[model samples]
Target chain A: MVDPTESPATGSSIRHEDHGDDLRTVRLAGRLDMLGMEPIALKFTSLTASHAQQVLVDLREVSFLASIGIRSIVSSARALESKGGRMALLVAPGSTVEATLTSTGISEVIPIHTEEAEALAGLGAAG
Target chain B: MAALTPADELHIQPDPETLRTASLWLAERCRQRSVPQELIDRLDLCLNEVLANLIDHAGPGVLEIPVELVLDPGDRRGGTPLSLRVRDGGAPFDPTAAPSPTAPTVLAETGIGGLGLVMVRRFCDEMHYRRVNDFNELTLLLAWPQETPDR
Candidate 1:
């Protein structure tokens, strides 16, 4: 379990690992509501701004996601798109997070994959 | 009619930090009632959106007026529905009046605003708003799924 104490923020913690070939995978855990979106949004925007290639956000561990959280993802994805980069999301099957993304039509704008390998491949193929 | 006590109530300052506190209070109440995780997630999401909207749009006078959250459960249509009433004396605003933004098809046209209200409406089964005595009261209702007996 990713501890919320890991970050100074109360609701979320984000950790990224380089997946080789310039692909970055970010794993987010905990509630991604208004209180949680601030720090994570900054980091996510920075990652997409700096990388500008392929960034896969894995939300399988995320227990809750609100509109602010959705805004962060949309903003980051838009930022990447402006620079000809791409953002993909890994959402667990049948999870509430997935349902929220689907309901907001975000899944249509950004590619959503249930498997990490597929998300990486989709992003890889985009480049 | 007699005044009824809420199952749980929270008085909070209209700020970003208090959003988390409110969620925790709801989570604790749900835990005590053995609410399912999925339903709990829906409640948390709606709570965050509603509270964030109040904090962002409700003006500086909102600071003087503490936000109130009241949680109660009642039987509705043969299922127990959880009700969350958010009362704020900040300003007169009706979220239901806000136009729902259409989902953008293209990434470049995607917007950040108005999506919060959309999520609040999408997750909760029912939503209502009223201005009473200079207070904005928004009520969100979610019907809990019928639980199956253990085999």
Candidate 2:
């Protein structure tokens, strides 16, 4: 089941959608800076904990990506991985978000796909 | 040598909200000057990390003293490096001297404490830190592309 309500604590909008077959998609939009990471991190951790198969993080609408934001994603990915699950990120090519992910060497650890289809395929969630 | 005057300056409270204000200020300045988006993003990232560190570790005194950011676009026509100076009147903490965190090979090994400094080091072309008087001043420099020439 997807949580449609956005938490006001983080000031960033995050909602989850169940793709069926135990696959889930969490879409995050707005700035993912220091202030915005707190609620998102908590929500993401809880979501990943509940859905143990696969979680696709869509960062297409994330206009800003900071170190703390990266930390949140990495931490959530780690949490999911521990439960035998995986997290993949969808980032547009040539975006600041993509560049930050690459420079921080996050792209090496997390699978980054430019297209939704590619990310789904990589996560084995393709229909 | 002509004294480098700050193109802009901001005095902000040492709070998380400053990150958003600082980023917007930097972005607007970059857009007006026709600075490349890549440089703008790097600058924004570095500023956010640096400010976040100060806010997190600068102790309670940071609330009493305002954090200052000075932007120096040195000879934009001649391709001199753009510099940002973040001044905080908190306990002396030199980020440049801090141990660089090794990039974790796996997800579980990734801890959040030292990664900010690592990103600051990697993105900025030059970094210098000085504790003069009671202020911790950290400066980051980025080389402007000569080919683009601010257009």
Candidate 3:
């Protein structure tokens, strides 16, 4: 769990790790609402703005995900997709990740799974 | 015939903390009324987005708004019309009349600086606007929040 004490101004935290060739993983937690969506958007924009080719957003620790947060994710995904890259969201069990994915109608466009491993594997295979 | 309905006005700074707290409190108020999930969902979204925009554009000032909640048996469907009137002492602008982004516009795709009022108008039943005494009154009405059936 990302300590709320040290979280960003939006009260959302970002943790990224390089998975494989041009693949990136980013973890997000805490309430991702309007105020929180700001930093999240910047973080994502910066991450996909780099030389990275693929980005996977991990929301396993996210407590709440709002439309603004969804917009950030979709924006980042579109940016990557424009470059022939891919964006995937890793959602944990009982998380509203499925609804967020469905709300944006991105589930059909992107891949989501119950576990990070499953989501990463799906993305790895898709990529 | 007389009924007991509660209506009150609140004044608070447009600070983000105050705005979020007020909206969250309003959500709790809706829950206490046992509003259905559907109504609650809309209220939750509208409350946050509306207030966020209010504080952002309205700048730092006292938000003089009236919140009127009525629990009426007028509708047999167990839904009561919810009225939320937000009057701000800010610049003269009506968001309801704002034009929506053009279809699939590449600009809208960025999704960084748009879609707040659009979503509210899309989800709410009716939004009334009036400017009086140098105050912008935004009367928002939504389909009644589902209430519990009389036992």
* Cα RMSD (angstroms) for every candidate in the order listed: 3.3, 2.7, 4.9
TM, every model:
0.89, 0.90, 0.70
Candidate 1, residue B61: lDDT: 73
DockQ: which candidate is best? 1
Candidate 3 structure lDDT: 0.63
Chain A TM-scores of each predicted structure, in the order given, are 0.89, 0.87, 0.82
Ranking by lDDT: 1, 2, 3
The residue ranges of model 2 lying beyond 4 angstroms of the native Cα positions read A5-11, A125-127, B1-6, B148-151
Model 1: how far residue A75 lies from native, Å: 1.2
lDDT of 2: 0.81
| Native contacts retained, all candidates in order | 0.82, 0.59, 0.07
Chain B structural similarity as TM-score, candidate 3: 0.73
In candidate 3, what are the lDDT values of residues A13-122, reduced to their tens digit? 87688876777787788777776666556766777555537677878888666667766776777767777788777787644445545544456555666677776777
Question: Which lDDT tens digits does candidate 1 get at residues B1-151?
Answer: 1223346789998677888788889999888777777778888888888888887787767766888898885553356588899999876889889899988899899888888888888899999999999898999989878767679
DockQ of each: 0.74, 0.64, 0.27
Q: List runs of model 1 lying over 4 Å from the truth.
A: A1-5, A8-11, B1-6, B76-80, B147-151
